[model samples]
Target chain A: MERTTIDLWVGVFVAMGIAALLFLALKVGNIGGFEAGSVYTTHANFDNIGGLKAKAPVKSAGVLVGRVTEIRFDNDSYQAEAILSLSSQ
Target chain B: MGVSTRFFFLLLLHSGTCFRRPQLILREIFSSGVLSLIIILVSGLFVGMVLGMQGYETLQTYGSEEALGVLVSLSLVRELGPVVAALLFASRAGSAITAEIGLMKATEQLAAMEMMAVDPLARVVAPRFWGGVISMPLLAAMFSAMGIFGGYLVGVVLIGVDEGSFWSQMQAAVDIREDILNGVIKSTVFGIAVTVIALFEGYDAPPTAEGVSRATTRTVVTSSLAILMLDFVLTAFMFRGV
Candidate 1:
């Protein structure tokens, strides 16, 4: 009976540990945050992105409506281009 | 003394034999680990609450209060979780381990076992050592999780930081492989270092009451210093490019 109690407690402890790892991976790491959804891609050109980065939120009217997907320098246009994936909502 | 210390460490190296039967190891874990878990959980909660309060006020000045979750989670997961948990483990479990073994030595129990042709190292020290090593990482993880929850409580419930923004921003910012996994690795290494030190100090202590007392004190001090130094080296190696 005592053995079972200890085993149960240790089992719970190990489960908690694994749950913490999963929380860190899924929530903090954003592993599954991006999923197949109604997303529209749009491109914008700027002289410079000014520290903007991929995965940075694209806000409109202080609302996060999309995220920056890709940023690159377009040699042909001699400008920085940013691709954004906007949620339909 | 030199010969005995080497012998103690050799026994530690082969301590994996203690795990041959899960039942023996589980008993050791119950005795040595339960208290440390409670300590880390309470400490983690308070630490996270403090971080949440502090992060909210500071970020509010810059209009970035939503970043509180990212700030609190990152700080706890990357640096504070392993470091603080290990320190607490050293003081609580580590000191207890040293004193327990030292007391046994002082009472000549270890010697009695040796006379009977029983290896005291394997029968006693190895189980305790393995218990500590197994406990540290789990304790650290619990600490981090409770800390994050504490931050959530303070930031979202009390401080009124937007809950969605707090969590979303944190998710976007922190990386599992880079931050959380590295922290787990750090705690595991710290666990090994602390348990080994505790066992070694106790095993090598002079078989006297005063000697046992001094060994307990040494367990905390030496393990703390070792933890800090190792944290520096590990942080340098793990985060060099980033």
Candidate 2:
């Protein structure tokens, strides 16, 4: 086989491998490329907090506006705080 | 044992030149990695589909069939993807490399290379070694991606699971750095263990027909065992807290 053909095949093989990794990262894992957009960070203090988990969808009028970034127990106030990272549209 | 250890060190020392010029390694990758692509992909799809069906069956009782994506992706990425891919790679590529090198040895090509003042370890072994190492993680990743897609097809399309919930659960569970990257690391280690053992067995085979055949068989059997053992050790270290 010519050297160029070998190089081409190897290039294709490597590209496929990289594409698979990207698919795993982006499609499967939900890890997107770095975003520098501003995110509105706010906290909501709920009495019960229910079964709220981190990364749970924070909905506004049944629309997903942001994600619940962290859920914390406030010892001082004896309340639950949900830190929401709202994407700025 | 001592000879194999020495061979391993010698191969490593000669590996610097293997990467300096990429042609040889590229050729090796073509033979091992490119050839194994179809097997990896087809097997991944079937495994994922089976996992989807079985997981749906079990999770259905709990009324949590939506978690099928989670079960499929987590299992594929964390365990099945790397372990099974390496096993296939060992049987497919590892045995082939052993046979090629073992036959070359039986034909006295290695001795001729030495007589011509060329180091067979450098000229022959290192490229295949690094080639298998390079192919392993990529093949594993491709296997996992194909598996997840298969799961999606089975779960959302065929089984009528909600598409939104299926993907969301998967994305939520399959962390790239934690789950996916660790699996890549595991496969890379398995790749190293497999290729090194294959090369050693082939290089050390007695220069006879039966010896070459036995070495080829040993490559498949030993490397498969090595892959499983290494997978256990790696999983213990990587997934300890999780």
Q: Which residue pairs show collisions in model 2?
A: none
Per-residue C-alpha lDDT of model 1 across residues B47-110, encoded as one tens digit per residue:
9999999998899999999899999999999899999999999999999989999999999899
B1-242 in candidate 2: lDDT tens per residue? 68888888999999887778788899999888988999999999999998889999999999999899899999999899999999999989998899899999999999999999988999899999999999999999999989988888888999999999898778767777788889899989989988998999889899898998999899989988988888888888886441
Residue B241, candidate 1: Cα error in Å is: 5.3
Q: Write the per-residue lDDT of candidate 1 for residues A1-89, one digit (tens) a residue.
A: 48889998777777877787787777777555444668889999999788787777788897767888898889999999999989887
Off by over 4 Å in 1: A34-89, B1-9
- Interface C-alpha RMSD, model 2: 2.0
- Candidate 2 lDDT for residue B130: 91
Docking quality (DockQ) of candidate 1: 0.45
